[model samples]
Target: MKHQHCRKAGNVLMIVGLVVMVSSIIFSVLNQLPSIQMPALLAQGAILGIFIGALLWLAGARVSGRERIEDRYFWHRHYDERCRRTPHH
Candidate 1:
C-alpha cells in the first residue's frame, strides 16, 4: 500500500521531470534561433546536453525484473560486449 504509492509517485515525478527538462531544451533552442546566433548555438547545445542527462537520470529510475535497464544501457554493455569483457583496470 504505502510502498506502492511511493513507487507510483516516483514514477510520476521521473516522467514529469524528464518532460520538463526536454521541453526546456526545446524552448531554449527555439528562442535562440534568431539573434545572438553563436551564443545561441552554445546555449542550445548546453540545453540539449542537460536534456539528455535528465532523460538518462529518468532511465536510471526504471526497474526491470528487479534490475535497472540503465545498468546495461548506461554502461554501454548491451551494445558493446567488449566493454563488458574488459576489466575495470
Candidate 2:
C-alpha cells in the first residue's frame, strides 16, 4: 500500500542521512590532520553533506508513521495497566 511505501522511503532516508552525517564528520576530522593536508573542497563538501543529511533526517522523521504507532502502544499499555489495577465487581 501507499503507507508502506512511504514508511520504506522514510527508513531509507533516515539510514542514508545517518550514514552521510557520520562519514562526513569522520572525513572532516581526517582533514584536520597534518599529513592528510586535504583540499579546501573537502571541508566545503563535508559541511554541505552534514547539512543535507540533517535535513534528510528531519524530513524522514516527519514522514515516518512511527510516532503514531508508539502512541498507540503507549495508550494500550496504559489502559491495560489501569484495568489490571482496578478490581472488577
Candidate 3:
C-alpha cells in the first residue's frame, strides 16, 4: 500500500539522519584542534538530516492514518452498529 511505502521511506530517512548526526559528531571530535575550523556543511548535514527526517516521518504517519486509541474504539463501535443494522445476507 502507499501508506506502507511512505512509512518505510520515512524510517529510512530517520536512520540516515541519525547516521549523519553521529558522523558529524565523530568528525568534529577527531578534529578538535585550536587552529582548525569545522566544515560548515558537516554541521548543517546533521541539522538538515534530523529536521527533514522528522518531517518525512510525520508526513508518512499522517498518510498511513491515525492510530489513536479513541479512533480505534470509535471505529469499532461504528462497525458493530453498522453490522447490527444490516440484514443477514
**All candidates' lDDT scores?**
0.61, 0.82, 0.60
Which digits, one per residue and each the tens of the lDDT, describe model 3 over residues 22-73?
6656666645666767687865665565566556555544554543545777
Clashing pairs in 2: none
- Put down candidate 2 lDDT per residue, 24-46, tens digits, no spaces: 99888898889988899988899
Worst 10 residues of 1 by lDDT: 59-68
State every prediction's TM-score relative to the real structure.
Answer: 0.45, 0.69, 0.41
lDDT of 1 by residue, 1-89 (tens): 47676567557656666776776676676666785455656676667766675764465365212135556676686457676776554
lDDT of 2: 0.82
**After superposing candidate 1, which stretches have Cα over 4 Å from the reference?**
35-84
Least accurate stretch of 10 residues (summed lDDT) in model 2? 80-89
- Cα error, residue 2 of model 1, in Å, equals 1.4
Candidate 1's C-alpha lDDT?
Answer: 0.61
